[model samples]
Target: MAGDTKERILETALALFAQSGYLGTSMHDIAKELGITKGALYKHYASKQEILDSIVERMNKMDYERAEAYEMPETEPDGFAEAYLHTPIAKIRTYSMAQFDHWTKEPFSSNFRKMLTLEQYRDPKLAQLYHDYLATGPTKYMAAIFRKLTDSDDAAMQLALEFYGPMFLLYSVYDGANEKESVAPMLCAHIDRFIAKIESGYRKPHAEGA
Candidate 1:
């Protein structure tokens, strides 16, 4: 089928892109990997850039789906610290673990991540994608959730930084092998510290009426 062939071409292109930086790869490489002629490849994508664009689009859809799946509760309970500590903490852990698994386990998803990370420095489009998806996107999403829960944009931003910053750092430093084993505990530990800090903030008394 036309759609199947197009999907195959994209998958092959992504693998090649991941193995060799985008600039390092060529249409011939993708076609050879797919066992298709260059002419056949053109039937699906007008150019190599078009293939990259399609891959980016597909990965972006996956990213949005994951983000939406981790939606925060609409209303906080009677106690802020207690509610967050008990509910979203667990949910966030689950969400983070799922993210780790997706980034490490899924071939297409993981390769897409690697391709973008490697190419971001060289390609402006990839750089923007890196910032939009991996950097600012998660932080902004968390900020919105924290704002709803804490009622303060500043506090929310702080919490987002505390929560996402270390995790992103870990991701950057992560080597391919044993990433889940190596990073899962650290991620959870960071989450624990982050929640403790949030709870500490709630316990602090306001300095006389300002």
Candidate 2:
């Protein structure tokens, strides 16, 4: 029974937080929506900050799981690198866009956007989660390919960003955009060009070097 209550509270809180944000939502709002007293709400969550913490924890776990499935070989030669860059680029982007689309259509969508926008101020720790995850995980893997393909560290980093930066940006933008006409194809094309550019840099100089 206690576990069930916690689940209900979390589900309600996630929905409300995604709609109104931490500041906009009150304990009374949660209690009233749940048809319970403020005291009952406190039994589950001490405060709004605690709720934010829980939400961030859940989001992080979801992100980590998604990234785990998409992991790539960090250091590989041209053949594997090219294949790595091509296959998952489109599929992952499209999957991410679909999730965003689903969320935007929900009543909590506006609040969710506001929380994402204002969350930096409210919880600095949560703000850095996405960057930290990308830098250490997915982006790190791609960076290895970039370094192998381009002798210059700056060039490699730039190339990796060219592929990932837009992917991240498009997921945020396309969540609310039209679904029938999506941005995934265009983003894939741009990434493909980036891959081709990386491949060009890896070619050995023939008589020009000799």
Candidate 3:
């Protein structure tokens, strides 16, 4: 029963936070929504910030794991480009896209999205964590993968950005509130286009061991 209560509370809070901005929500709201006493809610989560922080932490851990799974192999092709195109980096794209879809489709996805937008201006600390995960961490990871695949000092980083950039932009514009079908095709098309671009960029010019 205690376990069920904890899960219920978290689920309810997640939905609430994603639907309404953190500032707009109160502990009382959560308690009222859950049909529980404020003290019972407090027992589950000490504060709203604490609950939000926990959700963000879980998201961070999932992202790190997602990226880590794409670690490039050591014996990859001379530039690492082949391995990247053939293996880990490809997997990363698939993984990220799936994660995006999951978040967008989940019951609390709206709340999650809402919290993401709200946190940037409402809390610097939360924003920093997001910056680290979405911007800094993924950018660095993609850059490394690109470096390996293209054999260019900065080409890899640029390629990584180019490849995944649209997915972010598309999500930013749509935000999953509506037009699910209109946005879905483009989300994948952008990835496919980037893959082709990367392949063209990485092809060896004038072969024979120059």
Candidate 4:
């Protein structure tokens, strides 16, 4: 029950944070929404910031779990691109699309992303988190995966942008979507085309030692 309460507190805090900017939402609001007293909430979370930290931790854990489940390569001493080199493009595409679905669909991840987006402008701390989670962090991760395939850092980073930019744009479209179906097909088409492009234009030659 103690563990359950802690989970509940994080979930409730995240939902409230998404709906109301993190700064706008208060401890009282989370406790009230949970139908609990402030004192009870504090028993589980000493502070709202602590609750947010737990939420971020869970989000990171889920990200790696989802990546593993999809068989996406993880960074190694050599590089993730090296790991991805032997992996199937279809599997990579599956992992990429799964991450897309996760951020846009899964309640916890979706709420966390939305909370970061909403609160980013209101707090410098959250703004950095917004960039870390949604922007620079993902770009850097993808760039690392592209590094060995490209001739230079600029080229790798550019490829990362080219690969990820479309899906990045789609998040907002999906969020505003009346039906999720409207956005899913676009994502599907994108993954297919981009995978084909990478195979023909990039990875094949690399495989041949070009």
Order candidates by lDDT, high to low. 4, 1, 3, 2
Candidate 2: C-alpha RMSD to true structure equals 6.0
List the pairs of residues colliding in candidate 3: 18-111, 18-112, 19-111, 81-149, 146-156, 147-156
Ranking by TM-score: 4, 1, 3, 2
lDDT, candidate 3, at 179: 66
Give the Cα error of residue 33 in candidate 3, in Å: 1.5
In terms of lDDT, the poorest run of 10 residues in model 2 is 201-210
lDDT of 2 by residue, 1-210 (tens): 988897677668767766676567788998898999999889888997787677667656655554456553323455555555454545545544544443344433334444665554676664564345433444665576656456677877777777777766665576566662567676657666765564455533321353
**Candidate 3 Cα lDDT to native:** 0.67
Give me candidate 4's TM-score against the actual structure: 0.95
In angstroms, the error of model 1 at 105 is: 2.5
Residue 201, candidate 2: alpha-carbon lDDT:
54
- The residue-by-residue lDDT of candidate 3 on 1-210, one tens digit each, is 987887687778877776776777899999999999999899978998888777777666755564466563444334544455556446756865775675565565445655666666787875775566446665766677667555576777777778656656765666744667677777777877776665565533312223
Cα lDDT tens digits, model 4, 39-96, are 9888888998888889989988997888788877676725777877888877887888
Candidate 3 lDDT at 173 equals: 65
